[model samples]
Target: MIRVYRIPFSTNVERVALAAAHKGVEIEWVDVDPADRSPVREVSGQDLVPVLVADEEVVFDSPRVLAWLDERHPDPPLWPRDVARRAEARVFVEWFNRVWKGRPNEMEAELRKDEPDEARLQALGRQMVAWLDLFEELLDGRDYLLGDFGVADVVAFPFLKYGRLGLPEGDDELFHRILVHWQPIGEGHERLAAWVERVDALPRA
Candidate 1:
């Protein structure tokens, strides 16, 4: 059987697991501590969660894993057959990676420390709202990001779900206040709101 090494409740892991379920690809899930490296490290030669092992070949990184899944199981294809549309979808995937990776970095730094920076937090909140606005405009009348359900939607769904949940930074009043700054995207942007619902209704692993 194919094997996947990942941590529970991890967004990236969840994304891949969800994609696998969508493709109806059965896998043996291996839950591992991110801090400790032994077997997964030995297999994938990396410390990252979501390493995919299939027989003699080991695939690391989420995007590559997703692409491999699409290639290995082409049914219920996650990408379009048209070359131009496939390119566009890949471009959007790259943009989403940057947004997801950079969005919470500074906020997470302050959150891990004793003293949180109020001004920085406010700026981050504003930036997140701007992101929501961009997506809202892009999804104005579309059911999915790439005109149809595909890998792009899979990559975007987990983060958008967080936004729907107000991008909770912590369990406190300030976090809720920060959350409120952008939580209205769900109600304000009709298409994106519906997109969230559509993705939320999908089966998961």
Candidate 2:
């Protein structure tokens, strides 16, 4: 059986769980708190959730986990088969991980309650809006980033959740718009939304 070390609320862990479900791959979910980092370090030599231990092979990193799962079970493909489209999907996933994950300011207000600086919060809001604007441009008329709900969508969903929860406390209007935009995109697709719901409903381990 595949064992996955994860945290329920983590988007990164959620993506792996969702992909495993889509592939009809059963996983032994191991719940871990981000704060209690020692368990992970003891097992994998690094503190990270969404660690996949299968058949004595340890796979860390969400993207690598997805790729390993795909290779092991190729049906209901998470990545595009066409070369160009596959490259596009990979690019989006990379950008989503790198660029989208850098919006620490979105969570700054909550993280720093003792010294709430208005200027810093406002700057974070503006920066978040700029990033959302970029998403708007990228998602102009597409259902998914690469015209299909693939790995990119799974990777992007968690960050979107963070934006919805974090940014609203700082800038309500911007958060509302982003949430609205994302709702339809996520809801419009049957498989994608169903996958999300399945993961959301799963019994945490």
What does candidate 2's lDDT look like per residue over 57-80, in tens digits?
998999999999889989889899
Best by TM-score: 1
Clashes of 2: 0
Quote model 2's TM-score. 0.71
What lDDT is reached at residue 108 by model 1?
64
By summed lDDT, the worst window of 10 consecutive residues in model 2 runs over 179-188
Give each model's whole-structure lDDT.
Answer: 0.76, 0.66
* Pairs that collide, model 2: none
Runs in model 2 deviating more than 4 A are 105-121, 137-142, 162-205
Best lDDT goes to which candidate? 1
